[model samples]
Target: MHQCAKEEKVRVIACGAIAREIIAICKANRLGHIDLQCLPAIWHAYPEKITPGVENAIAEARAEGIERIFVGYADCGTGGLLDALCAREGVQRIEGPHCYSFFAGNAAFAENDDDVTSFFLTDFLARQFAAFVIEPLGLDRHPQLKPMYFGNYRKLVYLSQLEDENLKRKAKEAADYLGLEYEYRFTGYGDLTSALTRL
Candidate 1:
């Protein structure tokens, strides 16, 4: 974690999953008064660690005398632990169940039945598929785990935030590897734009 510059008025502790997109949003809107500190994107695979990691970040920010803070995560996989932390700290987080939900627009994503069968990915996951999915899950060595882990998933939906052809191709490859149908949607940061801009 990085220290917030004293000039910064607000600190947004974020998941590294959306770190790049947050930087893009802040840059595009000239939100230079905000400081971003991120936990490892790899933590997305470990929901249990999220709450404590965020709690530490909040303490660090408070130590630096920054009172205006926002958490750039959804409920994520923390059950309600992250929300409880935010409430106790008196801070607000991006409203959504997860990055995929916010990237697709919360209500619209909820209304879609395809989500029940769709495994989701964003640009970050597409780029780090092997590091995050394959090796960590042992899918690289135990290919059989694929069926056991993904048995219920029917499709891999890539909610893209950019028009990068390379990332799209990588996402398609991941879908093929998992034996899931591939669908691409150009979401372009969805609700994240509005949320960060409000900072």
Candidate 2:
């Protein structure tokens, strides 16, 4: 994807925990090297704030003449960080609404389908739900079994998961907060499955 982006004259710089993975994928496809770096701890914790270490990552990439940067990890994990870094460095950052969803369009991902649920089979998607869905819903709705609607269902993926004891607590809290419909299903990665299944 980066290569395609670059071939189209898109300047590309990559940062994230999976920087190595991006590097491997790019190299395997003979994508030319730009600049790559593992995310710093500060970037992960308080993404809005870039410490000296985080600055170093940007500097290293810049030194390689990378004109633009794209943080390659899931949005939940790196979105905040990307936002902060872009603000702090005055450098542009490109990320998707969600990381898994972003890859669906990238040629680097070789799936026949752009189904979001397919990511649930990956630990990557599991982590994304834990942050984006589980956490926010917990703070808001308290995690009750409920139906969720997006943009009037223009494109939606629906799947259900049985709540674990812990998920039950969060679900109850989410129910009170978000007030969306929820149902008991047999899987844990509901958010990804739902959106992807619909696609």
Candidate 3:
């Protein structure tokens, strides 16, 4: 094992989707002692890839002489596997089922059972709606599949990380594309900041 310095900086292995926000938060809070490494954001669609990807990133960070490492991921549809890996690696991760839940405040999100029929999108997801949601889901090539995919989703909830009107418009447009009602909620990084601050 590569030994680290006495004052080694903290390393965060994160999801690419939240990388920008994490950097912004760290900068704003003057948490310059931390470093971030992100895995491909597209892996969000493939939960099976997330655990190994995170493990590899952690190993790389460790090899780079990082003594303290944190994972910036939620369960993210990995079905407890991410948590298991984190435990085995003796690392910590954000608390929630997914980014949307944490951004909404974990406790509050847990209490809001009514949102089960709603689909969610964050700033990154809103920006990459075409590539992430539409193209990968094949809704672009087969518009007819929209109803089948979103039939149970009565509303599209845009969980805004920043107060950007452009992202809001895009999220609304995404809602329209799926034929679902539009709702907006500004979460502003919620628990992510607090979690990072703890480290």
Candidate 4:
């Protein structure tokens, strides 16, 4: 996952999907104290890999003499396994059940009922729609499978970390592809800013 120089920087074991956003936030805030390490973003399709991957990253960080570590992942479909790993290792992860929740602000996202049947996309998801979703889900090869996979999903909500027209268009195209309604929400970093700044 990561290799460090046994310095004073705080290591961040994070989800690769938000790696760009993390770099953006750190740069904007001048958070030069952090050392960001991300696992493969494709793991979103294989959640069983998250906890074990994070555990290994943690062990590696510790071995590199990095005591101060921050996990930039949410629960991320690992159920409570990530939380258990955090507790057992005495480390802290970003708040919220997943990126959608945290990027929308955890408390506010919890109270929103629209998400019940909404398929979500962040900037990364929008940009990597083909590799992350269409190709991985086999929708590119078997178009008929789209309906079966997204039968219950009513809409696609794109949570934006940066307001970009290209990403918005891509997101809308994804929604159209899936035969779902399109919704765009500009949520810049949300609680992720506060979480990292506090460290």
Ranking by lDDT: 4, 1, 3, 2
- Name the candidate, 1 or 4, with the larger lDDT value: 4
TM-score, predicted candidate 3 vs. hidden true structure: 0.95
lDDT of 4 at 179: 94
Evaluation by lDDT, superior candidate among 2 and 4: 4
**lDDT (10s digit) by residue, model 4, range 141-191:** 998998889999999999999989999999999999899999999999999
Enumerate clash totals for all models, in the order shown.
0, 26, 0, 0
TM-score of 1: 0.96
> How many clashing pairs in candidate 4?
0
Q: Candidate 3 or 4, higher TM-score?
A: 4
**lDDT by residue for model 1 (1-199), tens:** 4332346578999999898888888777878777899998888999899999999999998998988999999999999999999999999999999999999999889999868999999999999999998998999999989999999999999999999999999999999999999999999999999998887
- Per-residue lDDT tens digits for candidate 2, residues 1-199, read 2342234222334434334345445454445533344554224434344334455666776776665554333344544655666678875443344433343333323343534322221222222444655454453454333234322222222222332455454544433433434332233332332222221
Best by lDDT: 4
Q: How many Å off is the CA of 64 in candidate 1? A: 0.6
Show model 1 residue runs off by greater than 4 Å: 1-8
Return the TM-score for each candidate structure.
0.96, 0.36, 0.95, 0.95
Worst 10 residues of 4 by lDDT: 1-10
Error of 3 at 119 (Å): 0.3
How many clashes (backbone atoms < 3 Å, residues ≥3 apart in a chain or on different chains) does model 2 have?
Answer: 26
